[model samples]
Target: MTMPEQITPTGDMTVQTENLCAIFGGCAKCPGHAKAIDCGLVHLNPDALVFCIHGCHQLRVREKA
Candidate 1:
């Protein structure tokens, strides 16, 4: 699937926020970062902590060092 544009007429910024997660150096380093869909979402009353289906499928909590 093609990467969704950050700005859309829909006015949803979820995708843009998701990209930030990738830039955190975690998903950004992942093989699917470039093609990630429904990734990290940040907004009040969010539908879910992880909106990305692919990300959820492969979700793993990082253990504190």
Candidate 2:
């Protein structure tokens, strides 16, 4: 996957200002798919540093390897 160019830090996970966003709860397109579509997100936490303007349910965390 292509990472966003402008990523803003939110605690640990970086949010993409361009079009990336957290797909909370789940994606309606298929079963449990975390995707970035149409420059929007679903059921995202309001407090999340990197999130879509729409908002989603399931929260994803990133760990450096």
Model 2 Cα shift for residue 58 (angstroms): 16
TM-score of 2: 0.19
User: Which ranges in model 1 have alpha carbons more than 4 Å from their true place?
Assistant: 1-9, 12-16, 27-65
Q: Please provide, for model 1 over 25-54, each residue's C-alpha lDDT reduced to its tens digit, 9 standing for 90 to 100.
A: 454444443222333322432342222234
lDDT on C-alpha atoms for all candidate structures: 0.37, 0.36
- Model 2: per-residue lDDT, tens digit, 2-61? 344333444444233322323232234323322333333332432333434433434668
Q: TM-scores for all candidates?
A: 0.20, 0.19
- Cα deviation in Å at residue 63, candidate 2? 43
Ten residues in a row with the worst lDDT in model 2?
A: 17-26
